[model samples]
Target: MHIPDGFLTTPVWATLDAIAIPAVAWTARRAQSELESPDDRRIPLLGVMGAFVFAAQMINFPVGLGTSGHLVGGTLLAITLGPAAAVVVMTAILILQALIFQDGGLVVLGANVLNMAVVGVLAGYLPYRLAGRGKARSAAIFLGGFCSVAASASLALAELLVSGVPMARQLLWFSAGLFLVSGVIEGAITAAATRAIEGMNPLWIREARPARPVTIAVAVLGAAGLLAAGIAVASSAPDALQALLPGSKNAGIPEGRLTKIVLGLAAMILLYAACVIAGRRIARQRSA
Candidate 1:
């Protein structure tokens, strides 16, 4: 779910932005290292995969009660492109959505990225790896996809509560009910996509590796910091949600049916080109 700007208090989003910047930088570095020897196929695959994810996120299914959920594609990307590359792809998608569509708030861009990209990918990938190979691997893919959405929703709910939204507990339960169903849809999509991709091109699915101890420690600490900051800031501010509502209003882009199709095609082409160039550069560097 893309959080609009006004849902989070200034302090909460600000602190998350700080944490998100460095986390993204780290992910980029990791991706560069991982893709240093990228095969010719991988560059195109990255672009196509990223574009696919971007397009998929635009289709929101009605979850009843006027609520809707779209495909996040974190686990799908991770399963295909590796976690680091998935993070980069997701970051690109989020940035484009924020800047071009105004789908998410620019001010809370960091938090949104952190919640969807970093946390979602890791939550999914870790479980998939732990489940191992064979029959369990298929189940793990479903579990990973389910967990990714659920975890993201949980964090978003926590953020809302910390922002002093009224009836936090009630809203949390309501949102959870919606996501429970949505998560199952995501899991099925992920499992099907994984199977199709594996059948067509096994190389696209990278084997999962355990993170080094230091990396794990840092991630844990970062997550803790985000949670603590949200709680601490929320406790101090009175009417935090009210204060944010004034400036949080979003005027989104309106496009015709043809325009939407054209724009989607253009986005896919642009992402593919960008990824190809980056992949080639990284490949050259390694060769040199």
Candidate 2:
């Protein structure tokens, strides 16, 4: 879902970035405020969980068009972290993806972050909250996650359209039509991951900062070394190569993809390393 760099003109990217900068800052502040209650520990937990979600995204799912998409994991984070903080966690994930993995472009970072982080988390969590406590929890979790994925995909398509991308109708139709498919997959993945984490340490289920240093380290490494590689190759070769083979060129990258891949990976890798070290330190402190 990383809209490569250059997909949008300079003006659009610049405008979106300007808006994203403040929006992200506001989200962080909001998360901090939310942490003032009984779930202070959820702050670190959410951060680490965000990293884990990044790790899971490395496993790509084939969409059958010779192109594949990975899990966004927004709902999974929201289910565990709560709404406000979930945005912060996802913002971190998106930043790392755009910068280190080259999954998305820096110019379009704001749009991607807003769609995947803010919209997904808020939409997903609303259903979960409405479902209310206990036994209904899993059902709420699935629906919330499903809705989030659908909403994120729709919003992303809309952003692309508004940015003056050429394939507005096609892109929107492609994305929206896949909603049911994406929704089912997202729901199942979110449910499974949440259940696994909750089962591993029920305390995590109750909202405590993650204290697993090793898990944090592995997650960072996975995103940086493995997933980043996936993003790099996935965005570059297949689409571009296909474009060169007669009749396939029309479906190929829209000019600036190469640049987006380079810049995006560079940014994501740098951020991934920084986040890993920071997360490890936080994990160590929590364990101590």
Candidate 3:
């Protein structure tokens, strides 16, 4: 679902970038307020979740018809880390994917973040919250995850149409069809992950409190390790959009096994540090 460069015109991406910058900043502020403490577990959990999402996205599952889909993780992050924190985590993930791995284009990075992090997370989470925790929460999570991917894909398709890309109408319908299958896969994953996390440590998602430094270290390290491992096993299959629209020219770093591990680790570490710093700064600002 990463839109490479040249898919969007300059003006379209620029306008989205303009909107995304402040929106992410606002989310950061809101996350700090909601977490309510500099040492809140959600702060470190953001790092952990970001790493997990980044790694998960690398491993694409076959969705039949020669197309593949990967976990977007936006809805899962929102359910676990709160919507605002999910946005911050996703923004960091998207930026790293663009700058380090070149998985996404720098020009369209803003639009990617806007669609996946801001719109996707919020669209998924708001309804989940409205449904409330119970038997319905699981269903809500599924719906939320499904909607997140569908909404993000819709936005991306709309961007392509508005940008006047060649065969935009055909691409829109094709991509929408692909998302229907992908969204169901995403929904199931989101529901399963939420259930597992809730069973293991409900406080991780529900309460805002300080986590032990060692706990944070272990969580972050575990996620980083999984990211490194996942990169090695990631399928070479093209993602849905790539399968539908080939011949994109966005270049990325060579992905040797060692290079993938190294880059994945580096990206996770950078994300963890950035989220911690951002959380701290927001905490200080809130106190003042």
Best by lDDT: 1
TM-scores of all candidate predictions against the true structure: 0.70, 0.60, 0.65
TM-score, prediction 1: 0.70
Order of candidate numbers by TM-score, starting with the best: 1, 3, 2
Per-residue alpha-carbon lDDT of model 2 for 61-180, expressed as tens digits? 665769766766777666666667788888888888788878998778887876778767766765455443544568767887788888777656545554555453344446556886
Q: By descending lDDT, how would the candidates be arranged?
A: 1, 3, 2
lDDT of 1 by residue, 1-288 (tens): 788899998877988799889999998888877865655545566677788987877877665689776677999888777788898888888898899988888888988898888888877776565453544678889988998888777677667666766654345457768778878878877887788888998987877543344434544554454445444434543244224334322435353444434544565556645744553443344334
Local distance difference test values of all predictions, in order: 0.71, 0.66, 0.70
Supply candidate 1's per-residue lDDT for 178: 76
Worst 10 residues of 1 by lDDT: 240-249
Model 1, C-alpha of 122: deviation from truth (Å): 0.9
Candidate 2, residue 53: CA error in Å? 1.5
Residue pairs with colliding backbones in model 1 are: none
State the lDDT of candidate 3 residue by residue for 172-270, as single tens digits: 467668788778989987787778788998876643223235434434543443353234223221233333434532546564556645665687778
Clashing pairs in 3: none
Q: Which of the two, 2 or 3, has more TM-score? A: 3
Candidate 1 vs candidate 2: the lDDT winner is 1
